[model samples]
Target: MILTVTLNTALDITYRTAALIPHTTHRVTEVVERPGGKGLNVARVLSALGHETVVTGFAGGRTGDVLRELLGAGATARPADGRHGRRGRPRPVDALLPISGSTRRTIAVVDTATGDTTQLNEPGPTVSAAEWTAFLSCYDRLVPGAEAVALCGSLPPGIHVGAYAELIRRARAAGVPVLLDTSGEPLRRGVAARPDLVKPNADELALLTGSRDPLRAAHDTRRRGAHAVIASLGPDGILAATPDGLWRAAPPAPARGNPTGAGDSAVAGILSGLVERLPWPTRLSRAVALSTATVLSPVAGEFDATAYEELLPRIRVTEHPAP
Candidate 1:
């Protein structure tokens, strides 16, 4: 089973309207709520891919309770009538630990007319030192049984910047491959822990390495201790630098829709491939296809299975000599 850690879990609410105008009151057309956070998003995608995934993180208060209920309701996998070459069903399980601080809420306002999304995020509740220790204990128990673990998203208040680093070290000690996905100092420190893989977007790469060149930035991240670095280049696709080799995976065409959760879907793809023992090129191909499919999805944190299946074989993964 795949284990995912989302330290700052959120109740994601999406508000849809015909259009968004500045300084104008608008009537909402629809509201959709889901359990979210980077890791949860990854777990959702993994479940859709027919993987059994366990999610652990912080959840408390009314919002947290609602989040847990939504997650417990379970995800419905795409019908497997031999359409995607797989017949397995989705099984996503939640194993969140309680905390004193209430979980956060993220709001995304989607303008249907222009297909644009505006997001407003809240800084999550402050975690006490005791809560952190409790989470670590829980994580240790979960790690041993996991085929792979993903340490994802922002570090909530009261949590140390080196939190991901510590988790990475523990996962590594347990011989579980860990994927680190975050930004800023947490990612910087996490890389030093030498995770099995790290996924950063172009901006995060530049912020961490001070280089705009993706290949250079990826190499720098690898040198900093990540076994592999995959930098998302938006519509350009993903650039991966790994011990096996360097490769660029791109979609047949740029997909246009809500871009939220695309990176998490890519993380799901990579972890799915890693657990399945797929080669680097094929893994990247899956990441690219999944990410593109996420962009085509109307809702965040979900993907269009048809788009993913159609784009999977068409994704171009070209190898390049390691720089």
Candidate 2:
């Protein structure tokens, strides 16, 4: 089973309008809501990919209740037919702990005309000391059973900056392969904990290494401590630097649509590959294909199955000279 941790879970609400105009109200065309957070998003993709996945983190108040309900409701929304491979063990299990503060909500307003998204994310609920302790206890139990663990997303208010680092250490001690996807100081500290893998987008990579060069930045991140670094380069695809080798994986063409959960999908791909013991090149191909397919999907935390299957074998994974 794969374990995913989403400390600051959210209710992701999406609004669709014909076009977004400044200082003008527009008619809403559609609305969609889903349980979200980087880790939860990864869990959704992993579960869809037929991996037994478990999700744990913080959930409280009305919003938290709603988040858990949505998460649970969509748990088994997978194909029973042989399509997209065999079904995983009944979707992602919600193991979120309760807290005093209400969970946060994120709004994504999509312009149907331009296909652009304007996101408004609220500051997540502040976690208390007691809540943090409870989370640690929950995490401890889940780690032992996980084939791999993904520690993802931003830290909520009142949590220590080194939270991911601490989690990484615990996962490592259990001999579980761990992947981290976050940014800022939490990411810095988490990387130093030497996770099995780290997935950072282009902007985060540039910020972390102070270099705009993807190859150089990936190398620097590995030096700082990650055993492997898969830097997402958006439409250009992803660059991977691992002990096995370095490779650049990209689809033949750029995918167009909402790119919201592309990175999380990539995380799922890599995690699935890790658990299945696939080679680095094959893993990179899956990551790139899944990420691109997510961009072609209409909403976040989901991907187009047809796009995924069509793009999977076509993704190019070419080795790069060591830096």
Candidate 3:
């Protein structure tokens, strides 16, 4: 099973309006809520793709209860393809450790007229020392059975900055490949742990390496420690630096819709491909396609399956020789 760790799990709430005008009252057209956090989003996408996934992290209080309820119930509606929770395929296993502090909530407001998304995120609840220790115990048990482990998202308040780094080391010791998706100091330290892969967007990449150039920043990041770095360039696509080779992959065209969970979808794509033992180029293609499809999907954490299939072959993947 693929294990995903979301230290700060959340209830993702999305609101849709005809148009978003500053300081003006508007009627809400739609509202959708689901379990969220970087890792939870990845687990959902992985489950949708027919992979056995296990999610573990902090979940407590009322919001945590609702989040876990949704996860347990599975997807509200099954897709036509019947991949997610269909034919007895496993849904994401909930192994979340409860905490005293309440889980956080994230809001995404979509302007349907302009196809823009504005996000409001609350800093997740503070984790206690005891909670952290409990989680580590759970993680230790989960790591041995996991084919891969994803240490994702922000560290909730009260957790040390080096948390991801510690997790990376533990996963590495177990010989399980790990993918880290986080930013700021946690990212700086986690990269130094030499995770199997690191996925950072352009701004995060620039901040981490102090370089705006994608290739230069990616190379610098790898030098700091990651075995491979796949930098997300938003609509421009992805730039990857790995021991096997370097490559750039992009969708045939920019997709228009909510892009809330696009990066997590990309993480899911790469992890799934890695477990399946696909080549770098193929994995990158899947990542880009899934990312773009997530952008086209109306719901957060959901990808347009049809668009993904159509865009896979058309994605442009050009290899670059190591400098």
What's the candidate order when arranged by decreasing lDDT?
A: 3, 1, 2
Candidate 3 lDDT tens digits, 222-320 = 999999999999999999999999999999988877777899999999999999999999999999999999898755668888888989999999999
After superposition, the stretches of candidate 2 with alpha carbons farther than 4 Å from their true spots are 75-89
Candidate lDDT (C-alpha), each: 0.91, 0.90, 0.92
Task: Give TM per candidate.
Answer: 0.95, 0.94, 0.95
Compared with the true structure, what per-residue lDDT tens digits does model 2 show for residues 35-97?
A: 999899999888778888999999989999988988887732334553443433457898999
lDDT (10s digit) by residue, model 1, range 116-163: 888899889999999999999999999999999999999999999999
**Candidate 1 pairs with clashing backbones:** none
Off by over 4 Å in 1: 75-88
Error of 2 at 82 (Å): 13
Candidate 1 similarity to native, TM-score? 0.95
Per-residue error (Å), model 2, residue 182? 0.2
- What's the C-alpha lDDT at position 170 in model 3? 99
For residue 166, model 3's alpha carbon misses the true position, in angstroms, by 0.3
